[model samples]
Target chain A: MKVIETINLSKIFEGVVPVHAVNQVNLSIEDNEFTAIVGPSGSGKTTLLNMIGGLDRPTSGTIKVNQIALNELSENELINFRLKHIGFVFQSYNLIPVLSAKENAEFVMLLQNIPAKDRIARVEALLKEVGLEDKMNNRPSQLSGGQQQRVAVARALASKPDFVLADEPTANLDSKSAENLLDIMHRLNKEEGITFVFSTHDQRVIDRARRVITLEDGKIISDVIQHEN
Target chain B: MIFKVAWRNIWRHKVRSTVVFIAIALGLWAGLFTSAFTHGMMNQKIDSVIKMEMSHFQIHKPGFREELQVKLLMNDGENIVQAIQEEKEVIGVSGRIVTMAMLGSANKNGSVRLNGINPDDESIVTGINEKLVEGEYFRGVERNPILISRKIAEKYKVKIKSKVVLTMQDMEGNIVAGAFKVVGLFDTQNGMYDELNVFVRRDDMARLLGVGNSLHEIAVLLGRHDMAESMADKYQHVYPKLEVLPWMDLSTGMRMMIEMMDTYTFIIVGIILVALLFSIVNTMLMAVLERVKEIGMLMSIGMSKTRVFMMIVVETICLTFLGAPLGILLSYGSISYFGTHGINLGDAAYADMGFSNVIYPSLEYMDYLVVSMMVIIMAVLAAIYPAIKALRLKPVEAIRKI
Candidate 1:
């Protein structure tokens, strides 16, 4: 089942000399699959992920996420769709530095207007699942890089989003911390059937992803599916 | 949760938040202090006028104020006084006779208005006992005593108990003369009042002017000075033919001057507030720039633009609401203490502003409340530009931001 599909998608920054960031590309992401898009700097991997996640508009193509034409939706409707269906994690572990681990995890549910009682339970359950229940009240600054990423993953899954989009999630982490965070994400994907498409350059993250796509200079060069060991 | 986030965000950059809080507090304190100072100065001036010239309320014949002569006397002063006395707010009422007269010494000379009042009644209206500089207020009207202003006494070389001659028109329209011993001296603290007013027993003038059956004007004091307007309204209704003037309307020129001062104050304060607003806006815009990635993360996590906008505004509102009122409270304390002790500007300094001696920076409670509201409003409005910038931010670019 295709959870995300892009047909001839491209992104160009209009200037005196128009710069093409993402060249025409077609891709499909399977439901509950862990996919990694890896490329060197300036390869347009982030832009392609952004288009698929409804965060950016493709210059000339259709992006169908769960069979819905995202480009056709109004701005407000797109916001609603993102809120209800998509989750996001960032390279910086963008866990709202102001909030504690628990609060950051519950942010999406709060945006969903979920009742406080249910929101609390879901937040606690996700925090426990991420093995950060002891750090529930600790802010991102207080948590280790690995713990913060775990919190970000818990936050992404809080509202039961159909899929999660992570942009270089382990780019700012140490080797050990990156391995710990990737292990948590892999366990979550297997146990909860949550689809994830991440953009990264780290070989460790690529090794953990079930499918890997390689890109160079804004164009995809290879797509390979690794059999589960 | 948004409020919680906003509250926590303020503490994240403790030094910056503290500086913003202090800036807002200082702005509020300055605004409230100035507002309170204006209120106090205006009130002190008004009270000085009430104590020196008009009491809380004054009544006259229909055309008496215009003519200000013996001919404009109210024939039924006793009856009107009786009717006005029925109101509980009326503290004291006095019937008076006033005439423009020439006052002179052996060498120097000046013109003044001679006001004749029932001595016992006049004391209640003007606090004559408190204002006496020398000699004493007359006990009864039959003795025909007069109180000369201190400035007039010094200029004319008139001593207490010295006889002075006053020349004025009689009720029959002929120039008349009357002699009276100076029984008391007073300083009303207003240069105009001290130079141009003479007080005497009412019967003396009534006999000299030959208007024994009438009175020039009626002055009434009320329980509270602020109740003057409502009491004047009642007086106007009761005696439609007469002019019922409150102390404020009686001194229209001075009130207008004070009001003009208020307008000038508003203009200056308005400029400062605008500058302060821009400062706050610039600060919040900087926060937006620094937190671009954070905002993008919030939006990507399904926070709507409206919610982001609200969160920013709510944070501003909370900061201002907390800080501004504290500043106002500080202002209130400073003004209240100084208002009573009165930092003296000295006679020469006071005279520069055309005031008599001292300036009291007084403030009413309402003034503080108004300034608090205004500062808060400025702060909330200041948040708009930054909030709109945050709201319209595209999540993709914001997340990609450095």
Candidate 2:
């Protein structure tokens, strides 16, 4: 089943010289795929990801997640849809600095108005899955770079979304932390059958993905599969 | 959960938030303190007017106040004083034979109101007996004893036991002369009243003027000063032949002065609250601006605009509330202490203006609640700009900001 589909998506930044941040891109992700979108600087990989994640409106296109068109939703309805369906992991690990790890993980579910008992149970399980069970009570400021990223991952998955869109998840982590993070995400992907998509320039992320889509400028140049990974 | 987030967010920058807290605290303190001080000063003047000059209210025959004619006396004035003293709200009452007389001393002479009163009865209405600086209250003299103010004594070059002659008109329109000895020197602290009046035994003045038991003025003091106007109106209805006036009406510009001072007090408080409102707005705006990326991230992850806007408002209100209670407590503590102990002006300047030098600051419990409600309203008003700023943020553009 296709979880996310974007048809002819384009984002234009208008000025004296117009910049097409993402131009005429058509993309689809299956329900349980581990995919990576890789490109160099100014390649529109993050822009494409933002449009697909419902974080930005397309200059011209339609985005369907779970068969509902994003363009049809109002601004407020889009926020509610994002709350229910999209799990976002930013490059900077944007966990609320004031909340403890468990609180941050359960925040989206709380926004969804999930009952306290179910929210706690699912948040705890997700934290443990991301190897953060011991650090559940710690704030983001108290956690290291890799540890914060793992908590972000737990937060994203805690909502039980169809897929997680991560933008440079390991960009700020050291090599060893990055490897540890990738290992955890790979395990979660394979074991729980959760779909994951990432936009990155990191070679390590590209090597580990089941499929890789490479972009040049604002257009995709290649979509290749590495089944062994 | 939103409240929890907002409360935690306030502490993220402890020094910034603490600065806001202290501003609210000190600003409210100053505002309330100044208001209480103004109230105290004005109330002191009111007490002086009621106690020393007018005695809450006064009564005279219809034409006597406008023209100090001896023939315009209240024939039933003594009966009226006794009747007023029987009222439940009446604390004291006194009747006097009031006439303008040429008071002549060996050294000088001046025109003054010769207030002829029964010394014992007058003492009940006005506490003049307690205000004597030298000599006694109508004592140390045998015949026709008189009480004079310090200003009168100084101007006449007279002292206690000095003989002065009063020349005044009788009810028969005859100019009569009588000799009186000063027995006491008193200072009412109201320079105008002090300079214009002298007191003598009512029997002495009436005897010399050839009148019996007839009086020109009846003064009545009430238990509560606020009831003066209504009681005066009631008495005016009951005694239609006489004119009754409250203390406010008896003094020139008294009503305007009270209203002006009240307006000035509110202006002082209003200025302080406006200043506090700006301080909160600026600080909360800074807080919102500093957290753009975080706010954008929260919205991107599905926090509604309403929720985000409310978060800023809640944070601002929480910050304001933190200081409001402290400010109120400080105000209550200081006002409570000073209300009894009094704040001395350290000079007789206030007294010369007919106000007490030592002022006891006070506020009703309701004023605090009203001021608190004002602060809460100010906090919410102060929150609007920053909260709206947060709501206007676009997640895409905002998340890109550092």
Candidate 3:
């Protein structure tokens, strides 16, 4: 089943001169799909991802996630929707600095009001799966760039989200750390069947994606699929 | 969890948090200390007035206070005094013959209110005997011996045993003059009262005024000052023909001063807290601004705006709680120490104000509780604007903030 579908999604930035950041973009991602939206600067890859995650409202379009129209929800309702269904990983590794890796992983489920026992069990398992079990007590500042990003992934998966939206998640990492992060995410995607839609400029990330959609000037230029190397 | 996060968040900037904590602590300490000191001064002044002049309550014939006419004297003054003395609450009572007269010395002359008293009974009521600075208190002196303040002695260039003349009209409307020797010079710490009043034997005063056994005022001292009003009310019922006045009625200025003291303290502390309020708001706003990206991340991870707001408030409250109790305890310790040891203003400064040089600072525990609560409330109020500012951030945009 399609987990996310966007029909004619458009966003316009009004300024001294109008800028069409995303124009009439139609996209669909299936469950457990490892999809990459690849583009150069000004190609609106982040804007498209923001729209799909309900982080930004579309200027004119309908984004349906699991049959719920994202544009029809109120601001507060959209926040709840994102909290329950769509997790996010930002380029900057935006982990709460004061929280340790384990606490950060448990944060989303805590907000969901899940039972403390289940929250702790799920967070422990997710941290172990992401190879961060031993580093669970270290705060983000104590962790390296790779470790912090891994904690972010564990946090995103803690809520059992339907899909995870990642915007340039590997852009700030060293090459090896980037490759390791991609391996962990790919493994989680394969083993847990957790779908992921990422916006990236990194060629290494595109190389690993199962499907790639290339955009230029806010329009899709190509859509292609690749088998395992 | 929000509390845990908030508590950890404040310590992230150790220097900044410590600075705010110390500022609040010092502000509260200063406010409490100032209040205690002011209360001490006012209390001393009030106590002096009640002890040396008004006592707790006084009784007089109707219209006597309005005009000091000898005809408006209590007809049964001894009976009223006996009744007051028999009351369980009454500690002391004094009957006085008061008359306006001109006091004349060899070098100076002034108009003064002459008070006639039984020296022994007056001593119990006003402690006048304890205030004698020279010679004896109307003891072993010749006929018509008198007590004069040191201010009056210095003004008249007279000393103990110097003879002075008093002239006044008798009750029969006849003008009379009498000569008296100054048996004692007293300093009441009240320059105005010292200059305006002279004490003479009630027998001598009555003989000169030709009104035998007539008393214009009956002063009553109570064991507990808090019972003054009720005692006054009871006295009025027992002696309906006479006017019974509590210290508050006899001295309106003192009453007004006491009433305004609490209001003044509140205004003063409120102004201090307002200054603190601005400082706290500025600091919390800076904290929120510095953590925009992290705040956005939390919101994006499903933290509600209300939760974010409460986190800021909790952080502020923790900061306040950290400082307020320390400040209050510090103030309490300091006030208690000084209350026992006393803070001495120079004698000359307090001389004219009817106050002693040494003032013992005091505060009720309720005042500490009130001031601490005010500081906490101010802190919460101060946090609101910053918390609302944190809530206004759009997660998408704030996550992009550098």
Give the Cα RMSD of candidate 2: 2.3
- On residues A1-229, what C-alpha lDDT tens digit does candidate 2 reach at each position? 9999989988898899999988888888898889999999899998888888788889998889999999888999989988888888899999999999999999999999999999999999999988999999999999999999999999988888889999999999999999999999899888898899999999999989999999887888899998844
B102-162, model 2: which lDDT tens digit per residue? 9999999889999999888789889889989989998877789999999899999999889
Give all candidates' CA lDDT scores: 0.82, 0.91, 0.89
The model with the greatest lDDT is 2
What TM-score would chain B receive for each of the candidates shown?
A: 0.86, 0.92, 0.95
- Candidates 2 and 3, the one with greater TM-score: 3
- Model 1 chain B: ten consecutive residues of lowest lDDT: B347-356
What is the full ranking by TM-score, best candidate first?
3, 2, 1
> How does residue A162 of candidate 2 score in lDDT?
83
Error of 3 at A78 (Å): 2.3
Candidate 1 per-residue C-alpha lDDT over B159-268 given as tens digits, one digit per residue, 9 for 90 to 100? 88877888889978899888788888988776677778898877788888988858878888888988999889877987888889888887768779788879976876
State iRMS for model 3.
0.9
- Give model 1's TM-score for chain A to 2 decimal places: 0.96
Question: Candidate 1, residues A1-229: lDDT per residue as tens digits?
Answer: 9999888888898999987888888899889899999999888999888888888888988999999999999888888999888988888888888888998898889888899999999999999988898999998889998899889989989989889999999999999999988888888889888898999999998988889998777788999998562
TM-score, cand. 3 vs. native: 0.95
Q: Which residue pairs does candidate 2 place in steric collision?
A: none
